[model samples]
Target: MASVKSKAGANNESSPYRESARAGAGSPSLVAGAASLSLNSSRAYALEDFDTIATVGTGTFGRVFLVRDKKSRGFFALKAMKIPDVIRLKQEQHVHNEKEVLTEVNHPFLIKLFWTHHDERFLYMLMDYVPGGELFSYLRSRGRFSNGTGLFYTSEIVCAIEYLHARNIVYRDLKPENILLDHDGHIRLTDFGFAKKLSDRTWTLCGTPEYLAPEVIQSKGHGRAVDWWALGVLIFEMLAGYPPFFDDNPFGIYQKILAGKLEFPRHLDFYVKDLIKKFLVIDRARRLGNMKNGADDVKRHRWFKTVDWDAVPMRRLKPPIVPKVSHEGDTSNFDVYPEDEWKKEPPVPPKDLEIFKNF
Candidate 1:
């Protein structure tokens, strides 16, 4: 059976993607750097410029569609978010931050945001349409990955994380659901809604419950240390077929994170176990990537000893799971949605259009 893609931000008990407290503005200290990385394209695009192929995924504000450009006939993923829903959900700043961070960064593993535009009713982002679907679907189908396969996927993610940390950008969300595989099976990190460029700490209580770090759970003004913790959880899930911390509710999950106890399966290699232990430390300062040597220490770890740093970003290494994508716009890996899901809601004019002037 083909694996089905999960809903984007449905209100599930464990769905931390739909929850956030106060929305804050980015710090002024990083304004110049953010501006330098701004993406402004001269081409003018409209909603009618593309023909919708399918509703690939849904989010808190709107839906992601697989589309084909009328002029070039090229396939692209058009992310259209309802303006009124975004305003109602208090996600204005997060939308802006996603565009800001995506515009400025360029890495092999990160998704590319081609351009952005907004109308009175919706905000649209044009991006590369990765043919392969979510890594979550693939992981579910396989149950668990082998040590070699898990190492391959996690190594690619480590490179992406290192690049983000170098720029002082914190990718707070790093789960299988947020990662998409390209046709060649290389991972493309998506969903920058929770990502931020921070010079210090941010107090926002957000992110998936199973992946949240101890500092975030305690509301201790978290920074990039949270991502390292998530990475450790990701590594464990990839090998063990489940997260290190699981519970019947979010509160229960937090308790396990605070307790910081890990029970590794006996089959895990000694070096791999040590790597996970260093990453899951409750103290951020003691975390592997947060230490003095920085991400260098993580790359030098025993588990990643065989990784060729030079070849990782270059796509030289062979991928373990090359998706069987037939053409530019293949939706077989994604689940099918109702054809009129986006048409059900009538468009309502946004009252505060000034806030989205830059969009």
Candidate 2:
């Protein structure tokens, strides 16, 4: 999850999932705002409260650990980010946005942040431990999903996306890597580095190249419309086994996206194609979710006609891929990494202390 900062059109390989092309110059008000947000639960936590179990995920600024709470013996995903790396990478605002948004929203399909704590060297976010690993791993294992399976998963994501938009938050990062399967196999959206609340539009160049919208690539001020565009890319990847636009590099991928050429596999039906097309439209205003009806327009599309809206959020719908977890701390669903890297603490500079004062 290391962030790669490069000029536009450069090939960024740091993340096989989402990559941050440009980092914000840091936001003081935003950081202060995030610091003031109250914890979701009454229980306050710190690094010593949990015993580290395994390394479930890693990124540019930090790594996610599967940790067990000492008091309750409960399992949780602990996201530990190095404060110096956060400042050096210019991801302070994003780190704050993630905390603020997670602190504010509660959705069945979205990952939950229990509490946040910061010591001199690192920022820690305690969240629910999703035993099921990234949806990307499963998709690769299966090659691709059947129409029924794809529809079921996409429907759940639709519910999650709708929930965020209703609260005026745009989930700018939407990809298979960010989607995690719960023990029951339902989707739990993760990673809020690119998510932000928008009254109008934001002109930050972020997100994965394959899923980036044309508006985002052009640096046009974008709002929630970008989420719909990524949804289209997500649907395409789910159904076709790959994104519609592809190239060896990010620039080429952007070209294909701007060209707006979509070639579906012979297996995709007309209804599914129509749904993706509407979501992938180059014009933001004419896009399905950006239309007058908003997310209802997406929910009402013909491709999702079979979905039970009420059941989707209630988690009544069975997930297609139930991860084989042995116990509460079972991490068989996630990939293993060298544990030593997490032990080597990075040096923290004193100059950056005020930036994370609230943390």
Candidate 3:
């Protein structure tokens, strides 16, 4: 396997996915030194036109940079992945799966994939930049959210998962990191790397251990219902600031998760508690948001009575907390890391690898 390096410098290659931009025609040219950036034929503008002001976060696959569009003067999170490294790690199939799922999904609650393109070495994904950062970090900073705040966030996530399930796609990964905040502070589900289209059922041991459902850990023929189970865990974390089934040892947590045991805080609201119980049910057939109840059961929960279903996406409701960054290009408060440290040539994969073919 080849080691991966950050693609944080300019490169020459025409993007295979370039197309006209949906935002409009006459988008500005991408800026120089914008790090492996390229224009997709399907997109009206090149990704490099935007100035990358700061690094929001990083993961094993790639680093997400906070960039501003020179044309729209808008903010966006650019997720850059090394194609050669992905194929070398044998994750090309996973990448393909994510792209397929992303292409088919279009919903308010889900993270928007504006466009995707690839060059000789890297894959670039231009995505909706949610400024508020990870929902997990927000929760950690605040310790725990109020009942109202928790319900509001939970409701949005439930809708996103419901929509994916309806499309026959199962979001195997559901954690705070995967959940991002839109400009209005609403939850947008991101990172479809672990997602899979379930024609019937699948048994893959994937996803974070804490958020994994019992059926997933058991490697049973799990379906879309696993998302519902994770929703329960998500709600628990939101309300109590931690998952109901957690331990220092992952094995212990898995055992508790399999047992379907839960310990709610005394201060949790009755409705919230009840909803968690229904979602965390051991029997997938009996879980909430199943074919019977669908997403309406979650929307109709007593805790969500004040929620305006139509207005949630519009962000008409007051956000629990607004982020410090007020504008798209505002990086005044953030101390951006030096680009040189992250700029290095990625390793090339062997010719035998099929994953590097399309990328």
Total backbone collisions for each predicted model: 0, 3, 13
Minimal lDDT window, size 10, model 1: 26-35
Better of 1 and 2 by TM-score: 2
Q: TM-score for each prediction?
A: 0.88, 0.90, 0.81
- List residue ranges in candidate 2 displaced over 4 A: 1-38, 341-347
Per-residue lDDT of model 2, residues 172-227, tens digit only? 87888888888889988887777898888988888879988999899888899999
Where in model 3 is the C-alpha error above 4 Å?
A: 1-48, 331-338, 346-359
Residue 225 displacement (Å), model 1: 0.9
Best by lDDT: 2
Candidate rank order under TM-score:
2, 1, 3
TM-score of predicted model 3? 0.81
* lDDT-based ranking: 2, 1, 3
Instruction: Report the C-alpha displacement of residue 25, candidate 2, in angstroms.
Output: 22
Please provide, for model 3 over 13-47, each residue's C-alpha lDDT reduced to its tens digit, 9 standing for 90 to 100.
Answer: 11111110111111122322223222332554465
Clashing pairs in 2: 1-59, 1-60, 2-60
Q: Which is the winner by TM-score between candidate 2 and candidate 3?
A: 2
Per-residue lDDT for 1-359 in model 1, tens only?
A: 01111222212321111111111111101111101111434565555667878767654556667778889899877666666677777778778878889888899899877777665556666677887887888888999888998999989999999999999999988888778889999988887777899979988877788899998888789999899999999999988899999999888988998999999998888888999999999999999999998899999999999999889999887899999899989888776756563443344444576777777
Better of 1 and 2 by lDDT: 2
